[model samples]
Target: MSRPRSYDEPSVLSGAMQAFRRDGYRGVSIRDLEDATGLKAGSIYNSFGDKAGLFDAAFEHYNKVVLGGRVDRFAPAAAGISGLRDLFISLMHEPNGESHGCLITNSAIELDRDEQTYRHVCTGMDILFEVFLNRLAAAQQDGSLRAGTDPVLAATKLLALYQGLLVLVRAGRDTQALERLVAAEFHELETYHDARPAQQDIQA
Candidate 1:
């Protein structure tokens, strides 16, 4: 049999993911991976094949561990719209220093020419949009959102707002300003749904 594996696969992959997240795939060198993972060149080559292979594994790890958790926050709830609102608010409230914007967004910027990488990033984005769409549809069906509000359009707009917030956060905006912008976006969403209660209805 071949030599037994000596390294901690999960921990090494986790380190590789963070390194790739902080520096784009193109920027991360074999040396970087080796240094971050504590895996020598030979071990990395034998276990992961090459830089592209390591990146593919690392990207998947990042998606599952980092990005995947965020999209799940939009799960259907008593107040679907409110759930979506809270998800966005939490995202914007995340300490600015802790965010690297978004891993997929960063990958899109750096790996525009690589079809495989581009497709992977697009697929992740599609999943996020679909999650928002489901929440918006539930809100519409429950009458919490106004009739005639297209779920697809509303979802798209919400996703755009989220992506824009990521960009703003990456640009070094303060948390207070991000919170204000997030609140404004929520107000805009309510206005779009024409969701104001009448004065008479409130009194009753």
Candidate 2:
């Protein structure tokens, strides 16, 4: 039997998530985790089993709290295409101007071909994709999306654009340029959107 943890789990996981976001899985050391989580090496090992275990937990935390929260805040189901545009815009303006890069994007690049690491990356990516798909579907039903637009394809494109933008941000690309790109892409979607309702009216 193992001893119960006395420390705050969410707090510790948040710290670890930040560390992992700033530094890739291999880049973060045991000592670094100690500094980040405020837990001694023995305590960490005893609680999490190893660095990989802690990283896994941290990754899950990021997906659940950070990514999920952002989606809920910016691009909820009812927000539709406008909400998705805001979601993309929000990515450019990181809090406090911080740009540690997205965890899922960074992990996908750094841990490519590693099935174990890709599992978490895939989960995070799927979350975004699903959000895009569901939101677009809602937009279509509400006659906000262009008639005949395929939600799945649009969602996939948005997912790719999202990941690409994150890479550009991490590479120190200009924020204005990225924002403009997001605006232009969403503009096309909006362009068709305006015609959608009129088209529906004509059909009716």
Candidate 3:
């Protein structure tokens, strides 16, 4: 039987993800990965067939773990619009207040349309879109969403806004301005209800 691996898979992937996020796939070298992952070249090669394989594994980890964790922490189904606003706000406060940048956004900008990483980028985007869509739909069902706002359209706009905010954040744009913009957008979502008369008022 083959010998069992000694290294922690999640730790390795997390390190590789940080490397990839800090520097795009083309910018990161094997030596860089070795330093980031704490694995010798031979062990890296043995555990992952090649650099591409390691990157793929790391990208998947980013989608499943890091991104998923953020969604779970900030925007669960029950949380609704407040959750989404919190999610948007959280982007401005990444670990150490440093913008390593999102792997999906970085990959989409760095990789070509025909590249394999393109599919991974799409997958990550789809995850966020689905979360936005589902959350909006739930909010609408519960009467929290604005009057006559289509959940599908709102979710699409949210997905776009979310990606754009990440791009701006990575560029070191004024985060306070971005936070204010997010607040304005979410404010619009709830303003209609504020203007509407309550049930007792309607009856009176």
Candidate 4:
């Protein structure tokens, strides 16, 4: 009879994820995953199909566990904008804050568009894009944002900043610097309600 599996799948995937995050797909080998996960080659293949399958699994884990954590509170329309900000705040302070950047962003740049791993990367990016889009639209309705603003475009811009932060972190940029830059951007927002009282007085 086949021997029962020895290790916890989730735990193993988590370790493998760190390896992938630290070293891109092309950089890691089967032996590297074995060292990272403490599992034999046969076990690795039996559990996940191949290197690509294991990567896909690990990428999804990074998505739900790392990126999607604490994101639900911002699901409401106006709250999503806060959610976006909260996400970066949490990211800057993520445990083991070091050279490791976002797995999805790294994979997006490192993996081929036609590679299987690319789909997960795209899916993760889409999730962030959707969250930002929802929040921007809500802000517009609530008058927190100025009129004539396009939520779709604004969300894309926010996503760009976010992705850029990931790169900066990998390049050893200070989290404090990122915080200041983000704060400045938020401060520049011209809320519609900020001008409301003046407009009413003018009408009077």
**Candidate maximizing TM-score:** 3
Q: After superposing candidate 4 on the true structure, give the runs of residues whose Cα lies further than 4 Å from its correct spot.
A: 1-3, 73-78, 190-204
Largest lDDT belongs to which candidate? 3
Please list the residue runs of candidate 2 whose C-alpha ends up more than 4 Å from where it truly belongs after superposition: 1-4, 193-204
How high a TM-score does candidate 4 get? 0.83
Q: What does each candidate score in C-alpha RMSD?
A: 4.6, 5.7, 5.1, 5.2
The C-alpha lDDT values of all candidates are 0.76, 0.88, 0.90, 0.79
Model 3: per-residue Cα lDDT at residue 47 = 89
- Give the 10-residue window scoring lowest on summed lDDT in candidate 1: 70-79
| Better-scoring candidate (lDDT), 3 or 4 | 3
- lDDT per residue (tens digit) for residues 1-204 in model 4: 988889988888888888888888888899999998999999899899998889889898988886676566534444645556667666577567555667888988988899767888889889989888777777777777667778898888878998998888788789898988777665544344343467768899
Q: Rank the candidates by TM-score, best first.
A: 3, 2, 4, 1
Task: Name the better of 1 and 2 by lDDT.
Answer: 2
Compared with the true structure, the alpha-carbon lDDT of candidate 3 equals 0.90
What TM-score would every model get versus the actual structure? 0.82, 0.89, 0.91, 0.83
Q: Per-residue lDDT for 110-190 in model 2, tens only?
A: 886665757999999889999999888888788888777788999999999999999888888998999999999888765
